[model samples]
Target: MRLKSALSKVFASFVVKGIEKWKFDAVAAQERTLKKLVNEASHTVFGVDHRFVEIKNYEDFKARVPVRDYEDLKPYIERVVAGEADILWKDKPEYLAKTSGTTSGVKYIPISKQSMPEHIKAARNALLTYIHETGNASFVDGKLIFLQGSPVLAKKNGINVGRLSGIVAHLVPAYLQKNRMPSYQTNCIEDWEQKVDAIVEETINEDMRLISGIPPWVQMYFDKLTEKSGGKQIKDIFKNFQLFVYGGVNFEPYRAKIEASIGKKIAAIETYPASEGFIAYQDSQTEKGLLLLADAGMFYEFIPSEEYYNEKPTRLSLAEVELDKNYALILNTNAGLWGYSIGDTIKFISLNPYKIVVTGRIKHFISAFGEHVIGEEVEHALLSVANEEGIEITEFTVAPQVNPTFGELPYHEWFVEFVKAPVDLSAFALKVDKALQLKNIYYFDLIEGNILRSLKITILQKDAFVNYMKSEGKLGGQNKVPRLSNDRKLAEGLERYIA
Candidate 1:
């Protein structure tokens, strides 16, 4: 334990130094990284098309390469999938990270040898930063369980393909693998239920010091652990458990429930990692935002949320962003994704050291009646109502109910799964409606003008989301229910599960 503590201190110090160096002069660091990326990919097809050689500065680069979404780059990505070389990056990608799509059936994101190291480095730094901030280095001495997807990868066009989490699992450092839980054999089980069971059976008695995963799924793991250990809380089952690392989804809704399940307070670390690149991580224990990884192998652009849907949105670089404004994120990465829009929206909360909070998604919103309600508004409203009403909700989704066949005017329909159901369902719905109106001016106007009917709420049966994701073959890792949609696709699909 003494030796482990000493090593952890050394690791923490090293990470602090690295972070300091990267953040020394944020603008300068980003400029250097951008220059390096442009120079490295200058020989690629994309670079040639965009006239990379003539680009002398950020303005030149922006003027040449227009921002693009996954659909916009589909043609180029298709060529890469067909084993084409030097199309987007200098060389073909080493692997493709597959993510679920809303419009497209699936998205294949390239992961090059150069970018893989960036992902690994960012993850390591996130943990080490946590240790440095909290002085909790003892976690390294014990097991750390990460609820990841199956590591079994598939081949596509002779390139490896799989979920990002699964890919990262295969790349775990050799030394840390000794302290990682849920043996490789267990992680390979594709079925989430069986995998969780195997994990519980294997690690119930182990010296678990840390756990990491999406909050909802991690909550599921905690539930299973408690059940298997005869109703003891997770903290009782794993006495040394110290940290809970989460990413991929908003952790606010699940925070209270998870804390209750654990029966003790544990430090939580939040990260913002997309298949495109590792973006940010919670760097300070007291601060409420994630510090942007400015020098990672990616260049970033932000289009103000208000202008995001415009034909030609104004793109701002890191040095141009303002504090507390939502912006759609765009990226140029070493992994062959250039000027790519990842669809997520974020707001800068601090600028000196550069920190942000992910607000919502560009494609995930309800504007059918010009209410223009985004995921951020819905999440805020839900959390506000949940707190005010003393209710605990596990999962939820909102969609428009617009068909006249139902003999009612159009309204927003909500499907909610509650861990602690509200005593007065009608009052709960009313409270949520009022909260939404408060959050969105257009929504309020629509309701006041009687253009849209009152919102409708439907309680979902237990594990409704889990079952829905299971039916879609996306049961566990990184999959989440979209909070708001302009149409009824998701809501209608989940109708059968409504209680």
Candidate 2:
């Protein structure tokens, strides 16, 4: 009864918050958020430190800090390693989030103790939204399956130095553990079979209902779960499951497989939360509400889409930030970062632009022969073809390759682990080609003359990607496969299978 009452309260709060959010359109939210941001930035910059306190409107603090990438912070991390405060204001930051990013070697972004609640609150809001959507707050009653990173700590001299995931794991309410599932340590999932076996043993017989994790790892877990359940498919094994919540990357490619595995069309929500900040989420029916932690101690910046078209690109401040623009995102999180580019690009879908679709990564692109191709264009074209032909892409990647006969071809090769293969490759290829042409005229022109060849498709075993990620040691957590390769060597490694 206590659990039921608590869940009810959570649901009520979510419904209220969600409705309140809808009342204030995306642009209005930005209007409010930006004003707060400028005010906060003034104090934060002038103080030369980050902390949770309202700043008096100091004019000098309003100067915009230059945008920076992960590379810019290497020296600060070096300072932390040498036992100093580094970029953050606090003399002692509680811990740092160690998540892998593309083109950037392992990044150790400082995470603050003050910022921790903001993350937890966002996570809870996500859960509440899920419960409100599916009417399944009973998950708190059943085993709350979290396909998450483990809480394993490195013990130095008999004291625990928290792993990034561990700090978050420690925040899980003690009141909620009686119905929780096992957390397979991300560090330990290296022994895939054993970890899979343990999770299956713990969760299979129990009435496991809800799950949250990255799509790749969640897919792997379900794949393994299906394998051990007397050859029963995933859908059959977890038939009673009410929710399959996944985040950490784009879920569009793997959506069908997850639906097929679960047997029923469960509540499928796309979450855009990270260790850095809780930015957005998608729940039942309403256009993916990017529930912003407006009051969180973070000042956000947006770089207009037009900037990307320029040779020497610059970014847009919150003042200049407008609606319906694609921008490279920068965050001045409660975690010490001044106009830090987190590398993700998003298009504000509305004028009251709280809703943003993470279009692609800024650096995930290929350029050669005056043609620039990025993940958004590829995904748009692929999905356009999928919608036209009533087909779904399982997984895909693109690369620019040179041909002796032709100048260059941006090859869009993909492996589709479909339930049923397309009956007409020729027709599907033409559809995909047309979509590509529409998105980028340069790519289309190349295809017409074989400068860029026609689209290529490869059908692999359904679990091929799951197994491949496991084999490559990138199956779980924050890791996502790069959709575009910068050159031929890496592209060639993946090209032979293109049909």
Candidate 3:
């Protein structure tokens, strides 16, 4: 334990120094990263097509290559999948991360040997930075559990294919494996519930000091742990558990319930990692936003969210981004993704250190009645209502319900699965409706003009969202409920389980 603690301290010190140096000249660091990435891939098809050899700076690169989404890159990706080399990067990717697609069945994102360091190193640094910031080196002495996807990877044209978490799992350092719980066999369980059961059986009595996963799944694990431990809270079972490192979904809604389940407040660390790359992580205990990794093997571009859907949106380089504006993130990475849209939106909170808060997804919003409401707004409104009403929401989704018959006005329908139901359901609905109106002026106008009727709140049965996710074969890992949808597909699909 002493040796491990000493080693963790040394590593944490190194990471902190590295982060400080990187942030010392954030703009210069990003410019250097872009240059290196472009120069390395200069001979590739994409690089050559985009005049990479002549591209000496950010402006040149942007002028040469258009911003692309998954669909735009599909042709190049498909060619690579078919055994072609030097399509996007200098060589074919060693792995392909399959993600739940936004507009399609699935998205296969390339992952190269060169790109692996950014994902792995950034994640390691995030944890180490947290340890350094909080002086929690003892966390290294005890077991740390990462509730992730199966480690069993599939192959596609000789390339490993699986969830990014699963791929990263297979790459866990040998030293850390000693303190990591629930062996590979348990992690490889295909069924999420079965895997959670196996994990609980294996680590219920272990010296667990750290836990990492999406908030919803972690909450599920805590629930199971509490049930099996004769109703004992997680803190009672794992007395040493001190930190929760989570990503994939906003942790705000789950915070209250998760804290209650643990029976105490534990330090939490948040990360922003996507199939595209590991972008940022919470670097300060005092700050409320994540610090963008300027030296990570990716160059970032930001398009203002409001202007992104315009015919031609302005793209800003890292140095040009303004504070507190919602920007659609674009990436040009060593992994071979060039000028790619990751679909997530973020608002810069700090300029000197480049800190940001993820606002929402680009496509995840409702504007059916020209009352545009993004995921961030919906979440904020719901959170406000939850706090005021003294309720705990397990999960929720909202959709616009356009009346099929004449003489009926369209309205927003909210499906909420609560951990603790409010005393007055109608009053809770009224609060949420009023909160939404306050958040979006267009929504208020629609309500006032009778273009949209009052919001309807349907309290879902327990685990309705879970059941919905299970039905969709996405009950675990990185899958999450879209807070708001422009159409009725998700809302109608979840309606069946409404209480």
User: Per-prediction TM-score, please?
Assistant: 0.97, 0.84, 0.97
Q: On residues 1-499, what C-alpha lDDT tens digit does candidate 3 reach at each position?
A: 4788888888899878878997868899989999999999999988888889999888888789898899988988999887789999978898999898968678899999998878989888888888787777888889999999988899888899999999999888887989997798999999999999999999999999999999999989999999899999998999999989999888998998999999999998999999899999998788889989889899999999888889789989988999978899999999899989999999999998889999889898899878878888888888997986678988888998887466778888889899878888887888888898898899999999989888888889999999999999999988888887999999889989989
Candidate 2: which stretches are off by over 4 Å? 1-7, 14-64, 132-135, 155-164, 183-189, 233-235, 309-314, 317-320, 387-392, 404-411, 415-420, 445-451, 458-464, 495-499
- Name the lDDT of candidate 2: 0.63
lDDT of 2 at 439: 86
Task: Give residue 151's lDDT in candidate 3 (0 to 100).
Answer: 82
Model 3 TM-score? 0.97
Better of 2 and 3 by lDDT: 3
- The true-versus-predicted C-alpha distance at residue 45 of model 3, in Å, is 0.9
Q: What is the alpha-carbon lDDT of model 3 when measured against the actual structure?
A: 0.89
> At residue 72, what lDDT does model 3 achieve?
88
Error of 1 at 61 (Å): 1.1
Candidate 3 regions exceeding 4 Å error are: 404-406
lDDT tens digits, residue span 1-499, model 2: 4566366667657555765654355444444554555444344322344332433322222343455677876666556544564344354456666666656766666666667787776666666766666555666666777766656655422223454555677777665677677753533454555665678777887777778777767877787788777667665776557766777667777776677677767766667776667777764456654544445666566766547546556655444555656788878765666567777888766434356678787777766654566678878877776766667656666655455335544465555555566898777767876787788777767667676667666566655555556666776556677777666654555444433
Let me know the TM-score candidate 1 reaches against the reference structure: 0.97
Error of 2 at 54 (Å): 16
